[model samples]
Target: MTPSARDVSGKPQGVRGFSGALWHVATRAPAELFSALEELPPLVVQVLHNRGHAGVECIREFFNEPVLPHDPFLMRDMDKAVSRISQAVRDGERVCIYGDYDVDGISATAMLIETAILLGIDVCSYIPDRVDEGYGLNTEAVEKIVKDGVTLIITADCGTTADEEVALAADAGIDVIVTDHHHADAVPSRATAVLNPNSPDSDYPFTGLSGVGVAYKFVQALAEEYPEKLPYPETFLDLVALGTIADVVPLRDENRGFVIDGLEVLRQGHRAGLRAIGAVAQRPIETVTSSDIGFGIAPRLNAAGRIAHAQLALDLLREESASQAEQQANELDALNTERRQLTEDAVSVARQEVGDDPVVVSVSEKFAPGVVGLAASRLSEEFGVPAFVGTLIDGVVRGSARSPEGFHLAQFLGRHAELFETWGGHARAAGFTLQPVNLPKLRAALVEESRALEGDVFLGPQLHADGRVFPGTISFETFQYLDQLAPWGEGHDQPRLVVENVCVQTARLVGANHLLLTFREVAADIRAIWFQSGQHQADMNPGVRVDVAFRLDLNVYRGETRLQMVVDDVRPSAGERSLKE
Candidate 1:
């Protein structure tokens, strides 16, 4: 049966997607909005409307370069952080930049340390081992830093909520400037200066800065504080862009500006680490896009923390020597391959335990804490439920949880605070430590809690289209026009289009479980790729009529630029379905 929805463009849209998904097509905008943006293509206008940039001025401003980075002093304690760090620089006090293990943390750490060293401050970086020390500022790590005689600690991407650890450092005569972007439930009263835009005390205009983005702000404030000595702060946007995009923050406001500008710096090949990383990943550093960082380089950098020591990744980022950077980048690339295998194995084992539960909770000694998050995320996407995967080590469990929509992971974990040793994360993802015995209780609790859900969550597995496309309408030129809304990420996704009732020219299995497809068009055949969908080739053979949802992209292969359609979903056309029935 064809489920229909009346579109704003006065057409009937097929709303039911293949494999039980819901497809939403944005066919038009409000009359006033449409009239206001009549000069632009209707597809772009529809996309702009869906993204809530309906205002004419707002749309124009977006097309233009994003405004300059905001004033850093506007943050809650920018002055305090600058003054203390400047003092540390002047006095030659030993300082450390404590960072997390992920790409966001590693890149933020590198940026902050580079800034500090450039300012003539005696600084060293300390990123905790993901498997050994866990995340953030631990008391043991703080004590170790104290033993190193460090007097000041600048935390990058972490330490906002390390109240007790901050107190411990404060007791040992070390001051901590927590420069993080995570939500602060209660600002650490003991931190010398907390510089999170999301902090309760912050009046920073934008709250979406990533860990490295916050570090950029810190350095920007420092540049304003010391105009003469510090080198150009904009030089670090390469790192900022890498971290900001990798962290998956909304690519709006300052984040968008950073990526747009940083892509230039990253492409300049100034950073030896990124260049080497791009080479190892088979992505050209000179023309890297936000998409490149998210899929290509960032995962390799993150693999260091996931499979081994994060220090190696940090060393690569800070490496100035091309040879060393290449060696380290290659090492990270190998680790990424290993991490992929580990995650696949963990997910395979975890999948068997899912059964028919509304929520997935599985704990095993075989699950490594490093890749549990990936496994949990995979299971959540596959099963459309909250998944909690834990590594059972020595009677305790270090676990990661992932949820799709309509469930707040952090809030749910918070409700069961009594069962966990430590827990914290945002709405959709979280981590916790608890006794192994608590697994069954948490599982039962999650299932019970899921029963009360309104069930709208199950209605999803939804696909959103900016507009519709006919077989002959989408071209490379069309992609170029819509791409003016460039640097798409978390909140701003690349526009998708629905092409209904197109004839398949060919569908063949290509590299490693991917479907290489082509559709008949007026001027030329449209080449398409449906990655990981080789299993569907039988049904998508030549001459099959189908409705396909896809996004346009320009694939640069061996110096040739070709317009390619990345298929999102496909289903038999109404006529074909009727014929089969």
Candidate 2:
């Protein structure tokens, strides 16, 4: 019984677990470059080349060498930012760290507060409530902080576009130093110093730093200027890494350095809260990798902000006592569980509401403001189109937007600026608030804009297979060589290989929704598993010939380890026949 390639709606199903994507092998690397990399396997070299690391030096730097941090002062207004922060520390003035309500913002807030405390500066932190205060600086929150006698406000992961809030702070005799990474039309004049790599006037070499990355640079400059006031800058890399990975920044250049070194710091478990969280997640803190941070640690940290006050997460990062850290970790884990359920419900509803329109917009009063972004992200990936999920309360609507590749979310939102009360974000993701009165106009505008895009703009998702490989070639040695590309994420992905013309010797459903199978090719027989792919079980009968896209993995059971293939996609062999029934 070969599986059907179409869904119940008679639409072609995506390969493997992808909702609606086509699977294809990536182009082979240039023969010259492939031959020059004598030390690496052809497949590995092709993967690197396909990802744009074609030159010899580029490959070496990406895999072997660490990217040295650029001069911190190269950022626009870096000098002014450093000088004002120094004066605040020297004069014993009240300082406040203003942040957003996400993992990036929480981590940045925690990092700066920790750095300031080490310097014996009078400092406090504030993260606006996602539902009440919205994003960035709000007038009420700013007034309250100023009224608390805060003389200086240093923003972390936010305030790039807070022109009015910065002006209000100035009117109250408070200075602001903005450290953000979001795209901005122009530097806000009211801020005493703005440290954004994306600013039009910025000459910073790397523009992909996360909000916490920017904060790390500020602390880097601080440590250089006043060595005695701050600890070695490397001590804070763990926080920088968490934010960097969670924010999905490109893992190249300076960002690569941050994650590589930061993972080392994180493995040391110097932060008690992180250690406790790792324990709850069943991940060994001493051997935590980038995937651990992305899947285990970050979700719990972000849960606090989504379901409750972000201060809980900030507290977890700053907690010093082992018992206290354990308590905080448990609370966050519970919140994360709740958040996951809410997100699942929202996605289910959003999927049903999706029409034939190129853009998906789901509005519901039941939607939680904090979880809308998660719902939007799921919709975008599942439908292969831009998505906007909003929660309507009273007459105001707060929404999060996610875009597929080839679309710039920030620019799209900019064109609709007249409809938003507040809006800003990067190329792929953004958030905004608007009145219900503009809903009709916003929908019409998006439809027209989506129609204006190229006809093939949303032609499903694409799965890039590094190259075809024989089942017999998947040995432990090959896996070890590929493991050198550690800390894989957004820009740097785990290698996916195509194993062509293999016969399924046995197939079964396991763990509810997982498809477990044994694939045989020539003299080799290998086990494979496809998670959440039980729906395809009918197609994967014994003796069926198929080509599978998979990632090489090691499975351990009964204290024994063996190689296995984690299936990404599966299709009937193009031109192959099985010898056995």
The sequence of per-residue lDDT tens digits that candidate 2 reaches over residues 443-502 is 788778777775856534566667777766766766777777767878888888877778
Name the runs in model 2 displaced over 4 angstroms.
Answer: 1-19, 522-526, 555-562, 575-581
Clashes of 1: 0
**Cα-based lDDT for every prediction:** 0.84, 0.84
Model 2 TM-score, all chains together: 0.93
Each model's Cα RMSD? 3.1, 5.0
lDDT of model 1 at position 58: 80
Q: Residues 440-526, candidate 1: write the lDDT tens digits.
A: 899899988887784545523566787766666677767877788888898899988877778888888889999988887623545
lDDT of 1 at 332: 93
